[model samples]
Target: MSSASFSEQSSDDPALDRIGPALSRLRRRTPASSKDLSRNLVLNVIADAPGETTVGGLAAEMGVAQPVASRTVAACIAEGLLRRTASQSDGRRTVLELTEHGETERSRFAAEQRRAFEEITATWSSEEQIQFACLLDRYGADATAWSRRQAASRD
Candidate 1:
């Protein structure tokens, strides 16, 4: 993986030092599904969206180009994991919906991820695990907010 350099100077925080390496490892690890990470992510993004998901919305959520998202969506559709339909609110607009197969696959991937987390933290106490999970969820939320802020500033 490439170096994650925020600046010429390094941070004094020990956790910050380990974070880049940990994230790199997580990206390299594959899920228990036959689908690649991108496809799995498509299912996840669509399923988790607050409202109907369009191709443009998927691209934004994934932080990818529209064409890249479209291709991935096409692949998922061809595989019977997703379906495209006209938006109920707007006849001309299209939305993405996960098929039953996609839901099943998504559930499988999530279960595998949880299993891996359990295995890795097996030595930790149950309380410690719960605490870590809560902190991690908070971190993810904060990261997403930070990312969106950065993007908006760029725009």
Candidate 2:
């Protein structure tokens, strides 16, 4: 409501500053601490298909390097969220799937996130909510595009 409070960044604003750090700290877990969750999501994608999930397929879907995907998948396997069964057709290829634990954890994490989001945004009007969502989405896409251009220029 105050003009003084409104400002712009030379680069796109992530609005992380407005939300404080709890959400951001939780978000950092997304591609790291929630490795099991990510793997489970990938496995869910595979489950919809006719065949087992391959390491490379998971890697591409997660947008991570193959080695990182492999490490996360291995860790998920250890935690019993996934299984590392040897592919029947190919000895060198490992197939992954959500164990009962993986499916349960994935569902629980998803519910927690939903509850957290609802708790945070419950007071906003639907119009305000949609506007905020659009703004944040564009900010993220711009931030990512800026990063890619910066990387390309560096090279």
Candidate 3:
């Protein structure tokens, strides 16, 4: 990677520092925990889902361990971010969905992410914006693929 690309990957980059600080500030301002955020997002998905959302499926989709998903789902149930009920189609299945409050938090989180992305993209030229977006998307997919490969190796 060129120095520009290296800068793009650098956590020490001033732009990243700014974004990090902003996120940190937002986290402190909100009554959200890592588990809460994860569960809230999952609940949002489940609400729109057409079928029962299993712990294992949520784990796979969220790229987390099944236990983590189960615990988060359980916690969300406690926090009222989600509700669980027996699946009518399958007595052994668990149904999950976002509560009203969870929908609010999900909306808030999405808005914050959009605002941050907008802020970062605002400084780029149109061509740079398109290239940067493509680069970022590739980076995300590559990172996910690499992580899954690493996890499989560990197993």
C-alpha TM-score for every candidate: 0.81, 0.52, 0.54
CA lDDT, every model vs. true structure: 0.86, 0.68, 0.71
Candidate 1 — which residues are off by over 4 angstroms?
1-11, 32-34, 153-155
Structure candidate 1, residue pairs in collision: none
Q: How far does residue 45 in candidate 2 sit from its true spot (Å)?
A: 5.2
Top TM-score: which candidate number? 1
| Candidate 3 residue lDDT tens string, 103-124 | 8867777676667666757977
Q: Regarding lDDT, does 1 or 3 come out ahead?
A: 1
Report RMSD (Å) for each prediction in the order shown. 6.1, 7.6, 6.8
Better of 2 and 3 by TM-score: 3
Tens-place lDDT digits, model 1, residues 1-155: 23556442355557777988988787668575445788878998899777799999899989899999999999999998999999999989999999999999888888888898899899999999999989988987787778778878988
Q: What is residue 149's positional error in candidate 3, in angstroms?
A: 16
Q: Which ten residues in a row have the lowest lDDT in candidate 3?
A: 27-36
When summed lDDT is taken over every stretch of 10 residues in candidate 2, the lowest stretch is 2-11
**Which is better, 1 or 3, measured by TM-score?**
1
